[model samples]
Target: MFCYQCEQTTRGTACTTQGACGKTPDTAALQDLLVHAAQGISQYAHRLGKMGIRRNAADAFTLDALFTTVTNVNFDPDRLEGLLRNAAALRDTLRADYAQACAAAGQAPEALSGPATWEPAPDLAGLVAQGQAVGIDTRIAALGADLAGLQELVVYGLKGAAAYACHARLLGREDESVYAFVQEALTALAEDEPSVDALLSLSLRTGAMSVTVLALLDGANTGAYGHPVPTPVLMGHVRGKAILVSGHDLKDLEELLKQTEGTGINVYTHGEMLPAHGYPELKKYAHLVGHYGGAWQRQRSEFDAFPGAILMTTNCIQQPAPGYADRIFTSGLVAWPGVTHIADHDYAPVIQAALAADGFTDESPVRHHLAGFHHDAVLGVADKVIEAVKGGAIRHFTLIGGCDGAEGARSYYTDMAVALPQDTVVLTLGCGKFRVIDQDLGTVAGLPRLLDMGQCNDSYSAVKVALALSEAFGVGVNDLPLSLVISWYEQKAVAVLLALLHLGVKNIRLGPKLPAFVTPAVLKVLVEHYNIMPIGTVEDDLKAMGLAA
Candidate 1:
């Protein structure tokens, strides 16, 4: 088995024997099969579109299948097998639909090859064998490193966009164009020998689609939950039975809060859900208490120590340990082998588990973290920010955002944030904010130095704010006094990075390391095209970005 679609792959390269994220060889194999099958389905979905056959109905399934293969998401082999079967069935259905559509359009249906016409084996073992034959290593061997890497890059970006699009779909937002790009890119990947330039262009196209999806999801979230305001969330727990909700799914958190209201259970946000406290609709719930823990990487120890039920929503789930595994529950697409999964979003079990566990004996000393500086909230005070910049009260704005992982080098973000000049304002999101979540950066001209712009999914807020600032200052975003220091872990970050690239936002500093799947040849191309840079030391990067030169 081989997988390197995440930041923490083994040896900064491929993970052949097992994944660093507790993904067994078996699970990896099944994920590969699921992704391969999804590509097969997309192959037909793309062709049928030329005949004007729209299957937006099947778009959600494709998104789910691809998202399930994201790192630290669905590790359940059984679930992966089920998705693989569904993908095969969907592929056959789309194939037939495409043929019929061609006949109706008075055109001959062209025969397809590669994943388009490929068949899957019936059982899990056989499917694993099939997957091995079509996995990343096989593709790299068949297409050579550069072309294979570019294709994989495109697909990875699509996976991130599809995940965000799924979130938007859940919140009553849908865009067929985003779905079309998914199918179009997957169809490209199914090709035996696609051109490098074509793949690079398609990869950037995925970025454009990713930006659209991010905006869609952002609107869906704010539309449902109201724009986040600058709210102070208690960092300490209240005395009560608690249920810690992790991941970035706001809808699941809302549903659970509704069901557990007045049940004497406190719903605490964890990891990416930390921004839930800033959403007025979600925060209005009296039982929605506070935040617990840091990012997804610290969940094992954090969950073990917290004496209450835990709910993991969406991606960002690691393998559960026995210490807290019995009390843990999975919601949405996040799944574990032995952990209880609530695909229906039912919170009864979660509530019951919270009640069964020991409640927090008493309240701890009050501590707070500020969050909810979303685009609207930030822009509402845009005049003040612009004045501060003009008056030289604000020196630089560094966006130290994106995923947080267990690797040691990630402390670079924390250090960079702490060492930024007193006048510099820092914007943060995703689980990576845990690195500087507690830093009291104080205020510049009445604006807080540290702005928490919701979760990684809310990155649109960051980009929006950047674009607005650029407009206000009458300069391109590249000329603005802002620097993006992105920490990518999995595919979604890839999608976000692509969005930045698509916007022609250059000089991005990406770390803790480059993607292992990116060959040096592809890296050179990206570096030349986008001027993307690897993150160096805090001092050097700070000076380079005009922070402390």
Candidate 2:
């Protein structure tokens, strides 16, 4: 199995033996098979859509299947095998529909090849063989790394969009155009021959689609939970039975909070869920206690000592350690071989687990962190911010946001945040904020020096803020005294980066290292077109951003 779809891919290359995220060879093979199967489904689904037919089931499956293949989301072979079988079944059904539509239109059904014509074998062994037959290397050999990388880039961005769309769908938000683009792009990836130029164009289209989906998700979240406001969250242990909710699903977190209310159990946010505390609807729950740890990469140690039940609502789930495996529960497409999964939005089992385990006996001293500086909150203070900028009290604005990983180079973000001058305002999102979240950057013009926008998808908030600032100053976004220093680890970050590029945002610095899947030619294209650069030392990047460190 060869996988290099993430930042921590072995030696900044391929993970050939075992995934750096703890995915085994068997699981990696299954994920590849699942992606291939989704592509096949897309082939027929795309054709069906052109025939004036829409199948919401196929569209939903396509999103979930791709999301499941995201790194560290699912390690359960049994679950993957089920998804593969379901994908094949969906493909066959859609193919029949396409044929029926063609025949009804008095035209001969075109004979399709590639994934469209291929058949899956009966068992796991046969499926693995089929996966090996159409692996990444085969595609690279046929199309060259440049084109292959472009195709994979498009697919990964689609996956990220699908993940965000899935969350939005949970709250009854659906956009037909988003689903249409997802199927259309997947079918394009499975085409007989794809040119680098066409694929690059499609990659940008994927970015545009991602922007739309993220906006839809933002609406769903804010509509359901009310707009996020500035709120102080405790960072220490709380007394009594506790349950830690992680990942980026606000719906799941809300359900758990509702069920745990008045039961004498405390709910604490972890990882990406840290921003949930700022939403008025969620914050109204008194038992929804403060945040518990850093980012997703630190979960093993954090989960083990937490002394309560844990619920992982979405991706970034690592291999569970034995000490906490039984107590940890997964929901909404996250799965592990032996972990308990909660479906149907039920929380009785989770509540039972929390009661069964030993929760905190005495509370630790409370420490507070301010969050919820989303677009609305930031833009609400636009006048004050503009005044400060014009008066030279605030010299610059820097956005240090993206995914966080286990890489040592990630410390650069914390270093840069700490070294920024007092007159600078730091806006951050995603789990990467964990690096500098502990530091008190103090207030600037009556605003916290560091503003915590929601999750990675909340890059939408940052974009909105930038566009608003640009409008206020009568200049383009790039002309403002702002810089984006991003650190990425997964496909969601890919989607966000592409959206930034799509908006013509320039001089962005991306690091812990470039994606291994991005060929040199593609990298050159990005550098030339977007002026994207990799991060240097903390001091040098500060200087380059026009800061006197």
Candidate 3:
């Protein structure tokens, strides 16, 4: 199974035999089949939309199907097989509708291209098709590994958006258009003879939807939990039975907090969920402990160190190590066969796992780090930030954040931090901070030069900070003295980029090598329309940013 749709892809190339993320050949093939089936459903929806079906129904179908295939989200073969069957059934329903529409229109029903046309395959065609799709196929007859890779990149970006959208949905916030466009775009990806321009347009559309999805999640988070405030979360160990919740799903965290409310299980946010502490609603839970791990890549070490149960709510999952393998509990779209997966967002098994794991025998130990840095908290310091800029205490704000990977070229970020002028402040979030964070970058006046804004999802904080700065200075964000030098590795980064574009924040510098999935035409539109440029050497990129080398 050749899969290279993530930063952790083997050897900075494709995952040709087995996945670096612990995905087996069978699982990878299933994921490919799942995507293929979803595409069939997408085609069905497109035909139905042309025949006058309300766009919302079509989108919901596509969103759930696509979200299920995101890396590390669903590894249950049984669940995936069920979804594949469901997608095929939906496609058939869509096909029947198409036939009826054609009959009513007095036209012959054209044969749609997809699984609907598949026959018995004599060999392992899934990986071959994925490879050829990414490497060779120019048209839909096959997807070359690269374009297939690019399509997967776009699809993964949409998966992150859909996850965010689902969270927002629980909070009573809805944007029908985001749903509609996601469906239409997924459908477009399956079409024959898709142009580079069209795929590029779809990437931007994905970005646009990302903007809407983020806004919806922001509203849902702030509306339900109040805007995030500057609250210090204890990274120290607590005495009692404990449960560590990872990933970025707030709703799951909320439910766990409720279930373990009166129970002895102490709650802690790991990885991306660390920022949830700033939100008033979630922070109200006194038992909500501090973060347990660093980034997703460090899970094997971190999870093993903790003695309690670890609950995974979303992506960034690694192949579990034996140290914490039995103690790990997954929820929502995250699944691992044989591991106890809590469906319907239930918390009983998670609670049971926490109990069975024999959490801390003592009351608590020492605190480690602090988190909860988010938009509202940063905005609370808006006046001071403006004053600092006006008083020349702050010269410029640089957002240097994105996903992290094992590629040695990624060290460029560390180089960037070392080279950034003392007068500039580096704003960071996500695993990218591993490149340069926790180092002495000095300060801009009295303010620390590097600000840890949180995780990849906390790119929301960077966006909020940019918007607030623009409002205070009475200038557009792009005109402000801020530069976004981002490094990406996965789909979450894709959503963040889309959000940046939706905000019209231009001239952003992105690197360590633009996604191999983006065709040349799509790159052109991004470069021309958004003025997006790839990052160069620290020396050259700094010179371009008007920073002294």
Could you estimate the TM-score for every candidate? 0.98, 0.98, 0.86
Which ten contiguous residues of candidate 1 have the minimum total lDDT? 49-58
Q: Pick the candidate with the highest lDDT.
A: 2
* Residues 315-366, model 1: lDDT tens digits: 8888787889899998878889888988677888888999999979889789
Q: What is the C-alpha lDDT of each candidate?
A: 0.88, 0.89, 0.73
Clashes of each: 0, 0, 21
Per-residue lDDT tens digits for candidate 3, residues 150-234, read 5765677787788777767767888877766766776777665555556656776788888778777777887887877656667
Distance from true position, residue 276, model 3, in Å? 1.2
Count backbone overlaps in model 1.
0
Could you tell me which 10 consecutive residues in candidate 3 have the lowest summed lDDT? 131-140
